[model samples]
Target: MTGFCNMVIISLFNWIYILSFFVVYTADAGVQNHHVDKQNNSKRLLMDENYYTIMSRLDNLTKEVEALKKENALLRHSPIAFLAELTKTVSGQNHQIHFDQVKVNIGNAYYPSHGNFIASVNGLYQFSITACSTANHYVVLELTVNTSVVGKVLAGDTGYDECSSKTFLIQLSSGDDVFVQHKSQGDYLLSASAYGFPSFSGVLLRAL
Candidate 1:
């Protein structure tokens, strides 16, 4: 069933290709001068008819191509999406947070296994990090973009709920990396329980 559907789509694309050439060729034909003597009134009339016919065909083909593009877009899925969170508890003073489980990764630009989010395009981005601290301990996380600290989240202690989250909005160029890092703050650590663990998430605001 899938094979048949794919074949049908391929045929449609081929039709589009053929139609595009015909439109361009026909338009060019009308502009190119062709020699005709004064006695060739009938030949000129035939040429006019042919031009009109070609134009009508071109218009029809253009509409068909637009329709096909719309349908094709609906059938196509976005290959680049950025949305994920950590599945395991990650904590280290100088260690990067390895998310380990990606919920939605369209471009595969982010690697949870490596705790890195490499920007695939230059764009404005909004990043967020939620660090859960162990009871009586502390958690301080830093959001780093290209080795520069952009934001920080400090939470955990017997006083607070032991959850700290921070969101940052920044402009990133292609190949830049944004990630969360554990900052040295005593013996405090990031913790996760039945509710949820630490997570890092971000999305492209707009491509530059």
Candidate 2:
């Protein structure tokens, strides 16, 4: 009877120990699985943040590209040159010579009514003037920029019909005015014809 009781007690103790080991193992496995899950979640969050940052940068780049395209389109369509000629004989001192006939007025910068070129943009510009004098008469033509003399041309006083021309380069601001005026005194007749009319021209060389 004592041997049977001892065997029964030993078996009970063994069973209790096995149950405790199984409990410990289950708890440890659960902890390890939780740690793995936490690590995976952190990686997923970091990946999401990186994705958002990349998308924002791409959006800004697209906006900048669109702005550049619009600026290029505006530059391609702008106009900047003119050519004109006098329609009637002009003479005398300090007279603003109105070239009333427009041949190629690009941008409409040159006005035939007032005979002036008004700059629409700030830029480097080139201007030219041509004048023809009647036989035995002389005339002087001046190119003026906003009331300042910038260039001049002299036709003949040498007893024959003669033509003279001058070209000038200047920097102009927006709203500046350029025109031609008679600069000499006395009865000097300036002539115009289909073959050789007094002419004026201007072009914007480069925009600032």
Candidate 3:
């Protein structure tokens, strides 16, 4: 009886040792798995953050490129803007004249008339002229565009003897002549009063 009880106790101790060893090994394996899962989660989060950062930077770069493209398109389409820029560059570089009864004689003897202003260069030109008659006189004015006349204005008749003014616009090419000639003769002067006589002024801008 004593021997059997001792044997039973030894058998129980061996079984307890085996079970404890299995429990310790399982716990260690679980801890390692938990650590690996945590590392994987951290890596995923880092990757997500990096992706978001890159996306934001790409979006900003795209917007910047779009803005630059719009600006370039506007500059390309707006001729006035380009002309303003060009005028700024050449401002104060050339001689400008406000014509009021100013005689422009090309050489010495080619005194064509007192009314015609000739251009030397061939390009698009914008012309503006204003003329007035005073006192007992009639005004007959013609605005010539290239070789064809574009506008004509007449003032003063038998009964209506007062001050009259006319304005006109013309486009010219190179070697084009723009001028005014008096059709009637009387004791009337071109350009009277403090408002000044008939005048012409404008710049040659490129055509559309």
Best by lDDT: 2
- Residue-level lDDT of model 3, residues 128-186, one tens digit each, is 54544444555555566545667665544555434444444444554566654443333
Count clashing residue pairs per candidate. 2, 0, 2
The lDDT for every candidate, in the order shown, is 0.75, 0.85, 0.50
- Comparing 2 and 3 on TM-score, the stronger one: 2
Candidate 2 C-alpha lDDT tens digits along 1-208:
9999999999999999999999999999999999999999999999999999999999999999998887676466477999998868866676888888899998989999999999998888999999888877788788899989888888875666888888899999999999988865444646558447889999988776
Question: CA RMSD for every model?
Answer: 26.7, 5.3, 12.8
Per-model TM values vs. the true structure: 0.57, 0.63, 0.41
Query: Which candidate ranks first by TM-score, i.e. highest?
Result: 2
Best-to-worst ranking by lDDT: 2, 1, 3
**Any residue pairs clashing in model 3, and if so which?**
122-174, 191-197
lDDT: the better of candidates 1 and 3: 1
Off by over 4 Å in 2: 1-77, 185-189
Clashes of 3: 2
Clashes of 2: 0
* Candidate 3 Cα deviation (angstroms), residue 131: 9.7
50-117: candidate 1 lDDT, tens digit per residue: 99999999999999999988767544533445556666655557667777767777678888777889
Where model 3 places Cα greater than 4 Å from the true spot, the runs are 81-208
